[model samples]
Target chain A: MSELTLRPGRAFSMVERNLLIYRHTWPVLLAEIFEPMMYLLAFGVGIGVLVGNVPGLADTTVSFPRFVAPALLATAAMNGAMNETTFNMYAKLATEKTYQAILTTPMSSRAVALGEVTWALLRGTIVSTTFLVAVSLIGLTGTWTALLVVPAALLIGATFASLGLVVVTLLRSWQDTQLIQLVMLPMFLFSTTFFPLSVYPKPVQWLVEALPLYHSIELVRACFLGTGWRHALIAIAYLVVLGLAALLVAVRRLDRTLRT
Target chain B: MTTAPLIEARDLTKTYVTSEPYTAVKGIDFEVRPGEAFGVLGANGAGKSSTMRMIACVSPVTSGTLRILGMDAARDGERIRARLGVVPQDDTLDTELTVRENLLIYGRYFGIPWKALRERCDQLLAFSRLEDKGSQAVSTLSGGMRRRLTIARALINQPEILLLDEPTTGLDPQARHLLWERLFQLKEDGVTLLLTTHYMDEAEQLCDRLVVMDAGKIVAEGSPADLIERHSTREVLELRFAAHERQLMIDKCAGVTERVEVLPDRLVLYTGDGESTLAAVHALGVRPAGAFVRRSTLEDVFLTLTGRSLVE
Candidate 1:
């Protein structure tokens, strides 16, 4: 393999290429915006009417719509990040051979990995921000601390995006992409994105707590509710470590796969 | 007498360490000088692409030294790559983008300024005869047009050394000729070219100097004319007999030529005077189904060196 060098500038060029493609396919971006909105409408408003307010351990009661809003924000981040790193990355690597073309230039595999993750983070940010605006208009979030969801969603996006890249490198065919939907559906349902962890059995709750999406939901919820700063910091630390570790693995995998 | 070669490889080897370890390129030595059209000629799986990959700085050499433009391939890959234009065996153009957009994005990868890239993109489109299809999607183009666009994309950086791996592998005769003309223009512009191909005609038409590689090693090296002059006879007499009668004919034509290569359906007789050889064979009470005499080509040189045809 050639020397692996990380040039942030070259990574940004990859990001620019994605942006250029997205410019012509703006409808796809619009479609992604609707996924989080529909989730919010179905669970937050439709189901909230029947569930009413949920009790908190600190003698507080949070409305159902507000409770599910932050979890959906984290879900949006995961969906956005995973979609790009899996389908788009796979197409570029296998079908299109775009990564091979890029490698011939000055950009190294490290740059391609970094650039892809960064693009996923940007897409995740877009989805999370739009969801935040829709949720705020529906009177789901009242505190200024909700703004922190942007960075929280970004962290979640980076973590899942890096993991998605690793999965793509291991994948052999389009059929392997089905494995992503399998894992993602479980994470979406069982990670407390639609309901609280208390609804599940203690063993199930423990398993959910170990999930990265569960940590993301915890952090985003704490920010929106303007409470649980201590737990929020823990969630931030967990996501930060996960994102960095996954990024390192992703870069190493891309280097090995693309170079030789 | 001591000027460094533009591209140099000494004892370069590539051993793929997969489940079953395989070595694609054995230790070999070659040099490509500035502004020369150099070629690596070989059949499929002859380590041509592996060698090209190492020189392109995308694949690291398993051992030995490789320098491009006086820079070490392993240490200064980025610097070397910035000045190298590479046309890979397969077309890697972004099918989603327009022909012009493909060139634009490729130029951007080299950090070319937007204004200059736009101008250069136009020049390349014209050079590739793709100006009329500038706004068309790459997927809509024909195989030959796509190939031209790929070559245009590589030249977006105006690279000093252009490495083309089988530039005309799968194209019609007309398209191949047009591509050859364009590549000739690039050579005339004083850009050093290093291309690999199994097509003897392509090598003869485009290359100034070439090496014939068989398996993993360079078997012969010289200009096309020189290689033919040194390794092959002046002309070849091809005689086609029925499948069952080829051996009998070969035995009957003993001592008629310098060498005889028997194929599945024909026999190749290497001799200085093919017409006289054909007449001599006919005088032996053997009449071939078909007979033709032609001057020797690089293919005959490869056959003489490797004991196999170039296409096979």
Candidate 2:
């Protein structure tokens, strides 16, 4: 056929394909949801009763559920994004040689990377939406503004997921899966996900504020409390820049890795 | 453009360097015309896969020219890949998706829209005899079914060029036959094919023209029949002796053939006339367990050029 061309959306098609895998592999997806719910119960409700509400929070204008709920939304998005992109991406790229199969056709490594990030976003959106709905039903949501968290969660997921792609490509074996646990867990814990940056020492506050998850928490908190245009704008800008930068690095790295 | 060659490589070489440089594809040249089944026969580490990778455009050449369907591989690699189908030595099908989804998803990689992919997947599933396995995950399919799905996936773009790297390397005989049947059908539809293989019978059965490679260089090039006729005798005799009585039979028929090659297990006598060679051996009181005259084949030509079988 004349004028035939293959588009990079090939990776997007796999988003649908991946959803099918998720459809059958629900236990895996459910497990990711349970982690955040457990934190919400154990820390937000159980521990909040004993410790009282976390004060001087990033969005201190809200109650305890509203405060911790946004943090949980950001954390769950990060968790889902990292879980989907890191080990799954590694397993498929390494042992399964999934992208190799796609590259054999008209697909480029950029398409594969793009598709993977898209799927991660889709997955994170699902987890974020489900968690947002659960928190709203439990009367934690202050406004319909909680709905805006979907796109914000997508942005958060996109940044972490594609960054996960960069890491996955550079890692040579399963031994390197350790890096995600060591690196990401600490980032999640210390990046002001549980409390606002002001709770940390001034220097540590600056460090936490610089983290991608911190920006995600900022965005989610602003969206959850139904307030602050400037705050939400800054958070979105941070993640958008981080996402695009990580995507560019990943596309370039993947192009070298698979095409060369 | 009058039916440009599906694949062309000139002085193509690929070298992987880390601590020390190791060359894989060593300055080889060849062309495969549209719809032609071209075979690359080579011993292990002889650069066949590296050459295939360059033409597939998934790999870049360190030096030399390579083109697929008139497009430069170094530039417009994605454009070139759009018209190219690659069946790598290993089956690279995604295990997570179904057989049908595999085709649909890959077709999209070539930028085929969803509506068209849905239609194309059906036709390819029929062609590869994978229609029944469409929804089943590829991980559950048999080896043959998985291979058929791979072939189907490659055709999703209806590529003008198809590259098969050792297409039948690890298949059972029945599976090999099924794969060959599917390939033959594609050839009938005018898809140009380039294949790398070490199997003599596979090359003989599928290749219209062939190149024998040794140490990453072309040693001989021609049709299977032409190569066999040019490099080997019309017939050969196999001789074996029990225990260690070879000294009595060593000189008996030494002068009867153009050449004699001895192996630890047996002896081969290459001759133009097997009957006369047999008579000469009888006259010298030498007898063999089996005396048969068979048509020459590509294996003999390959052995003559590479000094042994491609696998060894």
Candidate 3:
């Protein structure tokens, strides 16, 4: 037989890898559009109908959707990242044994990990940007500051993509997916995704500040209304560290699992 | 073919620790020279798969030495693997991809350029008889088709030494023969192959040299011709009798040949002269319903050395 460490570029192209699932699941891709639309309708129209921009910040009044728009943009990015890193990843590694097939050639475990992570980031970024455009058409934000949400979304995606792989490696089977649902659902709910942390207990607020998703929410939220520099910087830092640390763990675990 | 040994394993052993600590492979020495099609014949749970996994670099050896292409399996596993092609027992193809895509992706994993990969994919597709199934998802393919595709995929990089782990275990006869023909071509092209199979006929047909593994140890090792010539007669005369009458023939044929082994419905005589053996049996007034003299085979050698009684 020919030599083994298959060159990874010959496997699935990054675009091909992530889009393979997306191309077949247009409905899921389109579902990303509805998230921002929901924020526009519920918070922008319904909640804005009552709150009427009374709380802090600028002197002028703004819509409620505008308030949640940034958060939703961040949410969409996180959601897109979550799906790719979790379900798609599980299917590839466990059910499909796609990585095994790749490794049979010259591709190492590192390439497989990096390929999937990079693919997730790309998919997450694409969805985040697509959501941004869709929301923009619906008039979510006016200033160019909202455009910054694109990269912010990608960072959020990258962080979770790697983190999700770490989770996947530990995950026993499809039956154990309840852990994914149970863990992520609460984090999404309590991480200030829907409501601001100021509404929580001061002690709880500090805890929220430590959460990666909370920082991402804050970064995207601030970016939506413009002037989100400091928190965005902090969120970027968290994502960078989270992404690298999770990637390192994932690579080590993959090396161990595939090597033996 | 190079004079250097393509694969060399010195005192290779693999042990597993569990509720039952078992020694899977107990310090066995193995070597396959270039252009040699070597086979490991074993029953189930014989540690054949474990040995192949180690050679493929997917499993780490517990102890002893293994060198592929003269590079240490422990240190240069990844490097050695790059020059080897492995067709695992399980069909681990990407079901999501077409036949062409599978070859392309696998070639790319080897870092082949896309342009070159495309050409190689076409050649492999045709080589595997998958030319018409280029766009077909692997899930939609038949077992034989999938097996062929896997072989083709393994060849995408033109490996020097091929490792086949029960390569045709579940294949139909026609598919198996077709695969064997392809493998024969590879061998003629000077590709060194390490194969594992339980089929004695397969070992006889494909291997230039073979080792019979029973419970992790090599019980017998030699070329098929050498093995049969050494352990058995030039020809095998078969005699069959009624279920209840087999013992009578066994009684009659005791000294008819070099040796006679009794079975439930048949008796096999290891002899130099089939016609004389048959005449001797007939002279005893015992008539067998069927009779034939065939060439000796590796199966007869296995039966001779390992005993035909149930191993399990």
Candidate 4:
């Protein structure tokens, strides 16, 4: 496939288009905040009562809410970005032909890919910030480094958004969409979100380490607990590399699909 | 108008690399001069949309050359597209947006300023006769209203060349005429128009010049009157008969007219003069059928060139 000669920042045109529609669809934005809050209430509060304090970084145990809060924040970032890229992007690309129409203009496929990822980042930031405020109010902040979660949420969002675009572009039938939920539910439940990696068998531990969500939770969890700087750097590098590769693949695939 | 062509193509081709590779356009050549309405007339799957998509700069040319507005289409697609307005065969309007907002948002894609686009948006709404429907959601609008809105959106950038593919394929006659009037006005204002349609009347009414395409190739090219005069006679005499009598009548009527097209239920006789031809048919002593004479049209030209009717 030929590479597109991308124009810098032209992707913002797509961002503006989404913002225009966002005027009437603010209710969807409201739902993003509450979805994670519901998880926090049930998993962090309800389950935390029985599970008690789990093992934490540096051999120190933290409160149950504090332990689960960062993981939930990372999940929120992933969900926020993935939701925008998967179903909504699919409708625009396959059903509504929005990208097909846009291609007639000066906009290239690269711009569309970058623009959607940027919008997903914005969405991820909004919901994660709200969650951060709620957890901080409940006295979950163990250190000032928890402020780093906002930028970390953006990284997590970007990574998932790019990866989701790659998947959505490859999606051929509506029935295949169930595959996304199948993968997401397992990753969310088993990515050390509610439990530690030590609880899993050695083979399962290696599998969880390979999953993207595990790295995301570890990165965000380190931010709140103020430890694990060396591991955090590795996690950040992993996400950054994965996000760039997915973005490249998404743009090339979109260019082939739209221009063909 | 400048003498130089606004768009030009030489041996342009488009082939799909599917499981079974299919070639949609077969090395055709054409040009659109400034301020003229040029058309490609063909039936479904004759490669008209593929040609339009290539000219619109959204589809890559498989081989050969296409240049729009003096820039190479392959190398300068973005620059050429920036100066062109395209109305695709399907209505790709954002159903989630209001009519005016759709125009505003589309204008932003061209990097138009918000204030200028708002003013232009109002003008476009009035121009397409959708002024009252500006704030309505796109999903609430009727088919004709949506088509007009799509046209309005295409005009947001004040494009020098307008490309429309099947601009009124499925519209009611009244809506089609209304759209024709709007397109005529745009031509009067000097925007070069390139459109494709299977409707011969639409080609005759809007196109200054056109090419007839069949099975990925151009069969004939000329003004509508020129094509009719070149390919068909001055008039056509139609005679309908009982199913069994049609085959017998074809042999009987062969020598009376210049050409005879045997349809399923009717025999279309092409002649220089319909009256003399009908008189000649009567002289043949076969009087057991219905008959009529009419002037030749682009439809007749299409039939003569392609050996098939435009609709089929």
- Model 2 alpha-carbon drift over 4 Å, by segment: A6-11, A56-63, A143-145, A198-207, A226-237, B1-4, B246-256, B282-292
Candidate 1 lDDT, tens digit per residue, B44-140?
9999999999988999889989989999998998888989999999889987678888898887777776788899988999999998999888889
| lDDT (tens digit, per residue) of candidate 3 on B282-306 | 9989889899988887778877877
Error of 2 at B211 (Å): 0.7
- Interface DockQ of candidate 4: 0.52
Error of 3 at A252 (Å): 1.7
The C-alpha stretches of model 1 lying farther than 4 A from their native spots are A1-7, A56-59
TM-score of 2: 0.91
Ranked candidates, highest TM-score first: 4, 1, 2, 3
lDDT of each: 0.88, 0.81, 0.79, 0.90
Which whole-number lDDT from 0 to 100 does residue B162 have in model 2? 85
**What TM-score would each prediction reach against the true structure?**
0.97, 0.91, 0.89, 0.98
Count of backbone clashes, every candidate in sequence? 0, 3, 25, 0
Q: DockQ ranking from best to worst?
A: 2, 4, 1, 3
Tens digits of lDDT, candidate 1, A19-120: 878888978877788887887789888998998887534524888888888988898888889889999899999999999999999888888898899999
lDDT of 2 by residue, A53-135 (tens): 66775444555656677888898898788777789888888888887777776667777788778888877877888888888
Q: What docking grade applies to model 2?
A: medium
Encode model 2's per-residue lDDT on B1-312: one tens digit a residue.
Answer: 376666778998899865888888788888888778999988778888888888888888899998777889889787888888888887788787778877876776677778988988889989988778888888898888887888888888888788889888778999999999999998999888899998999999999998988887888888988888889999877777765567668667677787776666666788887778778888889867656666667766776676675565
| RMSD (Cα, Å) of model 1 | 2.3
Candidate 1 structure, TM-score to reference: 0.97
Top DockQ: which candidate number? 2
Return the top candidate by TM-score: 4
Task: Provide the lowest-lDDT 10-residue window in model 1 chain B.
Answer: B241-250
